[model samples]
Target: MDMAQRETWTSRVGFIFAAVGSAVGLGNIWSFPFQTASNGGAAFLVVYLLAVFLIGFPTMLIEFVIGRRSKQNAVSAFSELGYGNWTFAGVIGVFASFITLSFYSVVGGWVLNYIVGSVTGGYLGDASTFFGSVSSGTVAVAAHAVFMAITIAIVAGGVADGIERATKFMIPAILVLLAGLAVWGSTLSGASAGYAYYLSPDFGVIATNFTSIVPSAMGQAFFTLSLGFGVMVAYASYLGRDDSLPGDSAIIVVLNTIVALLAGFAVFPILAATDALTGSTGAGTAFVALAGAFGQLPAGRIIGFVFFVVLLFAALSSSISLLEAPASYVVDSYDTERWKVAVGVGVVAFLLGIVPAYGYVGLFNDFVFNILLPIAVLFIALFAGWIYGGEAVDELGRGTSLGRGAMTAWLWWVRVVVPIVVAYTLWLGVTNFYAGLVNGAYF
Candidate 1:
């Protein structure tokens, strides 16, 4: 009986593209390639695919359920659903949003710098040396400030005109440029070698790598799609109950998966063809390998322009969503003004972003994808499974026959299976993260 749902998108396509835009950023482009390489490419892909179906879909439905049910942002949604302790989960969404956006904006800054550099032909030389020259101190800080400003400006402008309009441009550009790059990459001299490295299977590696791979793959699936920590909940707060939650979530999940798969096609071939596949193996893998590939292109400058432009846009699209998670709570629950919410969140998040804006970018990035995301997702699953309880199934399954049947089994799996697995992975990630500090490990 809440009367607070915001007006949603005008069309299905617009909504779908927005979700895809959120899901398809560096997680797919930068993170996925390196992850695929480190974990046996095709074998890890198999495990990843399985994890997406088993854990990702159900969990997504869970968040959407919470969002739609309460018809409010994360905090209000939780409190509105019933009362008491659950409201704290909504606040957690705000905290997670801040932590996630801090590092994300830094990486986004790198994407912007690359686009500018690409257009300027800065990557036309030896990659290893050029990459060493591009990171940190001045360049990173400058780009970081520029990207953060863009995020803040957009948030300050309000959601529909700012977020929606920007995403419409960025999402299509990302897809078109990526597809073009993949096609061009396939035509390169050694493209097959890269394709083989990417697509070839190695069962033995998967067997030995499975323990570590579980946490990594699980983290990727959740973070790439912006699941777990009430992002979907916040987004769904814009919807009406007449629209089916489960049906909507299905479309969202499918489109997001397509974007992720498309990214692999766009990036891996270029790396293999340029003999830069090995470059993605280390600390500067993204800068070294990707810049090297762009440098080798016939008109690497133009390609770099398009590639990083799309990456910058992708990061912005996702960052807006991250910011909205908290802003929505403030604006919706407390009746805060949109302008105040925007500036307050932006100023606060910008200050916190400084921590990861410098030398700790990669480590913080790993901690986000590897640790924070999984923990948030586990809570979301439990909320859908136990907190929302049978109401989750009813809420999700209200419109379509497929949705009704789909919700039943997914609920059980989330309730019983996913939490145990996620909790175990969280333990491993935390322990390994601590061990790295104790042993001076940097991977």
Candidate 2:
């Protein structure tokens, strides 16, 4: 298939929803709250907002320009841009997407189990024990297969009818449901405490843990925005030239942040009301802590059902994007049929997912979240800021309202500032991983 023959987003609304769907995923629902809870609450939110605007926006624009300009998959985008070695950046992105989907589907399966349990009153027990039972063995694998099957069905529809149509409904439904949850959460008896814990800034904590908090904030910003994985690049390949890259990027960031913040509001109040906060983070926070909270609520069954349904939507919206990146690559690079490529990618990702589904979620997450993701973003910043340089500015300016001075400033930030910060964060991830290995006696 020729590049020109590729499908474009049906409209700007479709593009925005598709892009936001990619950005707003499990990270927003599962990871963001725990991250905020562990890393200074509102203090972390402050730093995270800074990271989103300063680091996230610039790097996002870089991906948008590259994808829109090349109208190719991530790998071929770099390759077509005359950066042969830089093609590794796209390769890193595709691999990262695969690694991410591997463990991501595992977590998705966990969420799926919770959804079933919530509806069937099966979650009326010890939350920790329940999570443990569902997280591994045959049940986990079965749930993972079901989740991947739904994701593949959407991806196989190709760009317009599949991704765009699905996200159009999914994103709006997610927002509406989340808003309802937030309202209900605020009405809980302990809502005040939850709000205070989530919104009350502690400068003392930020000052004392500057090094730790900043890196966490930066990583969360990158993760929630789905950067460094060629997702934005793949989504943007279907973008029309008339769309404003900067404007669309800003809208995606804002919508994603809203969803993340609302998740905190919806979850924290319920946790506080039920005394189930427990200082937990990560998968345990969502599955165990929140599950326990739901079990203790007045109309516990109904709330649990709705909450898990929201999670399912968030997970599916994001998972499809993850699958789309590599599937897009296979179709564009191999000149293969889209449906065939989608199915092939789905099967391979499913097989790989079994590794993490069985119990390696931590290891898979460590590789993708802590390492590959940051490094991929760093490479993108280097390419945009250094290699692509002025041409990138022209691309950003193309079909948009950016004036000469504005474009120049955007270019400078992408080339100079964003790279320096991302490189520093990348170094932090590398050293942290090394230290973990050494401490564990694996090195």
Candidate 3:
């Protein structure tokens, strides 16, 4: 599609919904709570919130400026703006999106199986065994393919008709269902204990593990907001100059944080009430502990069904954006039809996903989260802050009413602060990955 003929969001609200959908996914509901609980509880939460505002928000604004200014896909955005070699940063984003979706779709498949298992009571007998059975092997591969197909179909429909329309319904449904779940969870017998564990900070843990905590918190902020990858850039590409990047970015961050907190409210209480809080982190939290907790409830099956349905929606919403990063790149670079590109990308992702589906999720997860994502985001910070500094500020000021002073402040923050912090985080991530390898952690 030509630049003028390129599809744009039908409305700002639609764009916001789509962008929020991209952000609020398994990262919020699945990863955020578990990461927070595992990494010093409220101590981690404090760092995560700071990272969101200081690092994530600024980087997001830079991405929006880049996309809206160039009116192109993530990869083409840089070159379109006359930054020839810096397009490499966009390529990293596209690659990160592709790799992320490979493992992510496998997890999405797990959600699909849970949705079915909830209705059939397949997991009631032994949640661990059921998750194990569905998480790998032929069943897992089949489910992964099914989830990828759904994502491809949505992307093939194009932005306005497909992505925006789907998110408008899905995002609201996720929020409403999550709120209801949180309310019900608050009534559980051990609700106070759960809240205490989640909300009360352990300052000593942070003091002792500050290095590890900061990186983990930074990664969670990036993951939950769908930053680091080109999803935000590609989504922003569909935006018009009339949309206020700062306003929309604040809304996205705030809503995403709310969803993450609500997920904690909904999950921790149930785990505490059922005494299933032990080993309730990572994938085990969702499939094993929570599934088993549901089995012990009065209307276990019904609640389980609703919870997994919400999870499925969250998974699909994020997955489509991941696929779109690469799809947009291919479409913009090669001028291919969207449907064909979607199918092609889906096939490759399914094939790449099989290794994880066949029981290697930890490997893929470590690579993407600890290695690829930090590198991608680091490059984005450098590009936005240094390479395209003044131009980025100019682009950011286009739609909003911010004065030159505010814009200049943002430019300096992105240029100096973001890159330095991101670089340090990237170094920590690399070292952690190597340490994990030395300790045989991923095996």
Candidate maximizing TM-score: 3
Q: Per-residue lDDT tens digits of candidate 1, residues 247-299? A: 66677777667667777777777777676565335446776787887877787
Candidate 2 lowest-lDDT run of ten: 276-285
Q: Best candidate, lDDT-wise?
A: 3
Candidate 1 minimal-lDDT segment of 10 residues? 1-10
Q: What is the TM-score of each candidate against the true structure?
A: 0.93, 0.97, 0.98
122-226 in candidate 2: lDDT tens per residue? 767788888888999899999999999999999999888999999999899889999999999989998899899889898898899877777678888887898
lDDT of 3 by residue, 273-364 (tens): 99865453555456787889998988889999999999999999999999999999999888899999999998999999998888778777
Q: Which regions of candidate 3 fall more than 4 Å away from where they truly are? A: 278-280
How do all the candidates rank in terms of lDDT, highest first? 3, 2, 1
- Count the clashes in each prediction: 1, 1, 0
- lDDT for model 3 comes to 0.88
